[model samples]
Target: MSEIPDAQPFTPVSDVGEFGLIDKMKAALADAADARDLVAGIGDDAAVYRVGAAGSDGPSRVHVITTDALVEGVHFDRTYVPLRALGWKAIAVNVSDVAAMNARPRFATVALGLPNNLSVEGAEALYTGMAQACERYGLAVVGGDVTASARLTLSVTVVGEAEERAVVYRRGAQPGDLLCVTGDLGSAAAGLRVLLAGKDRMTAGDGAADDPPQPDLTGFAYAVERQLMPQARLDRIEAWAEAGVRPSSLIDVSDGLASEAHHLSQAGTVGAVIDAGLLPVHVQTALAAQRFDERAEAFVLYGGEDYELLFTIPEAEASKLSPDTYAVVGQVVEPKEGVALRLPDGNRVPLEAAGFRHV
Candidate 1:
């Protein structure tokens, strides 16, 4: 006698990857017909909502929200990461989104999935770091859920508010606008490489008999700090607002310049020209790239998690920005031109993202 087994459906996540899956699932979710309050959805940095009558003036008052999650083994390595830094990153990344919308973070809720290996002291350290970041960003932790899991997982949701007129989005750039960025690029990814380089070198017999092998993270401290505890560009956004330099389009550089630029250009129905020589590179990032037998330009174009601001402004408004802090990287062009990078040698080539993917 043979036994029959029930059939199970199978599909590979890699077949579609992150963006494709988002498009599919987004198509499946039906939009509300009479949803007047919804300002932005699915594709943007955050979901925007128009609250009641706060539009006492011309523009409506809006609230923006975003969520992010990090998992052990997939996003980070336990051998190198500290609990406090992990906690700060969990909240800082979300706050970066709120900043992108030209808003200030007001509240947050945390949901944690913990494994048995973590202790009460570890939990306290994590919260301590979260609290410090909340103070820095002028936000408060409202509520959350805690559950058991095989490894540590953290999810954070943030809420922020702004005037409708002040809220910047991905889809507003026009031709002739100058592309710009705050601070340097690619340091965080280089830092991760330095960290991994140490981890990959360790073996059971490599250290003294009594002591375990430890990564000597000296001279490369800049990269390590950028990777483990990068700060969102909150001050720059605020300064821009005060200086009356409203961006025609804006995005946070969580992914590299190329990927985020593609997102901006695609949404705006425009084209872009990323200038390779104009990219700001930290000294440590350059040295790290050389150590890894790679070029710093690749990191500047393809590295993710920099948390700097990528934005476009009219050539007229570009004059208001401080050049030392904001690097004018490129320009927006007609849609037919498509997205491309202008190399130092005067060659123009298509711009493509080489950032990470998880599915």
Candidate 2:
């Protein structure tokens, strides 16, 4: 008898990475739903669908939907990250996605996977934290499901609304558009670095009986808070609306400056050059980077979870934005030029997505 054929090997997700897997899923689900009312289905900060308003003959308003999940070991550690902060962050992250689409987040639903060892009070504290964040962002927590799990997990979904014409995507950037970002970058990453250092100190037997020595966070409070709870840049979206200016393309900076820049460039089939000198780094963030003996620019480039908005706008609209809140860091270019980072010394290097990756 002929020998049996060898079993087929399966592909690991890491081979193609997080975005590659998303691209594969996007292709497979292209025809899964009707396309008539779908504004944007996949490969965006949020999914937008068109729906008519009640008793209105005017243009349909679009609903933006987004979801994000936080896993215990992967996203946080209870030893340093408080449950309340975790809860607030869970909701804020999804809101950031909606804001990235230039929509106003109105409601949210939370799905939780609870570990059996957790206490009822612990769960309630989490919800309380979520409620606090909801109050601040003007979001209502609807309903969701709960189930047992090996570790604690929280998944938040947000729904937002906007006029059909107000929605922005990541594919409309032109060669002359200016690249901008709201607020400073890398502060959240610096915060995480501070928290992790504290954790290491505690675990290394640096505490007295019944009391432990904590990391001296006197000057790093801003960085620490940024890591534990980061606010979404919804204010920038509101500012744009008030000024009657819209970005040609928009994305939230959850995956660092370099990665998000590449995203905008690839989405628009254009090229970009990020000026290293123009990147805005917070004072506290720079201090944290120095404390860790790391380059401040590295933090700004590769620090994920900033939750700031990264976008491209026409030169005419750039003047309308407040200089205090926004910074023009680069310019869009032809596709042949690709993406590059112009160093302060005038040297240029290819800008790649070396930010956070799921895989």
Candidate 3:
């Protein structure tokens, strides 16, 4: 008999990082799937497909699909993150991806990995929160699957639709284009810090047996609420449609400002220069950062889970947007410039992707 060779050593997924793993998968699967109707594939926020033949006017409308998974210890902690809030967050994260494509979320399919200890009522409470979010976003829960697991996990897939011309990708920004972001940043990360601190105190037996401790949320209500329940930027999409404005390139701030900025820069083969003074950090976020002896800008630049929309548009089309709701924070530049943050004192520093990494 011929001698058998030893099996090759297994490779660790962490060696490549999250996005790096995605790129490897993209290359490996390039020829495995049909590409006749595929519009956007693995590299973008969501996979988009052309629904039908092109109309007389132009190209056909497209469908957007995206999925995200939230694991117990990785994404949340039951000690501080309530069941209802956890459920809502699971759906909101997927919805944010749909909005990033400039499409309206229409349907969702949820899959739950229920543990043996979770009761019927506990599962029902989770569904209730999902229902509330579905109603608020005008989405429907079409179907799903339930399975047993050692730890709780939620996986949500959201489907959205949009006109071919309206769908935005993260690859169209040009040099001199203005960068804009919606609402504020950093509150979610600060809130998470506060929650974890509270959890640590409780674990150390901070209170009497009869008087279990609660996190002191006084004056940090806004930050705490933002962390528990994040809203997808569908409203911004609607407003853009009404104003006949479309971003050249767009993405959601789910992985923090610095990370998303690098995504856009690399996707478009350009560079992004964000002004530090222009970043819209919330007052509550600043106060929370102070309590922890951290800079608010650190939270703004590195804090994931903000779920705000960040996009770039031509300066000529800037007049279409309302200054009150959208803030121009930066501009696109040539790839040689790379991604950098312009400080208040006029010095520039490299902006690194130090945001949340799945691996």
Name the best candidate (by lDDT). 3
RMSD in angstroms between candidate 2 and the native structure over all alpha carbons? 1.9
Q: Estimate each model's TM-score.
A: 0.94, 0.95, 0.95
Residues 218-319, model 2: lDDT tens digits: 798988888788998888889999999999999999989989998898744899999999998999998988889998788889988989999999999989
What ranking emerges by lDDT with the best candidate at the front?
Answer: 3, 2, 1
Per-residue C-alpha lDDT of model 3 across residues 23-77, encoded as one tens digit per residue: 9999999989899889989987888998865555665788999999998888888
On a 0 to 100 scale, what is the lDDT of residue 264 in model 2? 92
- Misplaced by over 4 Å in model 3 are 1-7, 53-59, 206-208
The runs of at least 3 residues in candidate 1 whose Cα sits more than 4 Å from the true structure, single-residue gaps closed, are 1-8, 32-34, 54-58, 204-208
RMSD per candidate (Å) reads 2.3, 1.9, 1.9
Predicted candidate 1 versus true structure: per-residue lDDT over 1-359, tens digit per residue:
87788778778888778888888877777453355788887787887999867437666789999998889987887788899999999999999999888788999999999999999899888898899889989899999899998989999999998888899998899989999999899999899989988886665536655665666566789889988887988898788878887999898988788899898886548999988888899999999998999888777788888888899999889888777869999999999878889989999999776565534
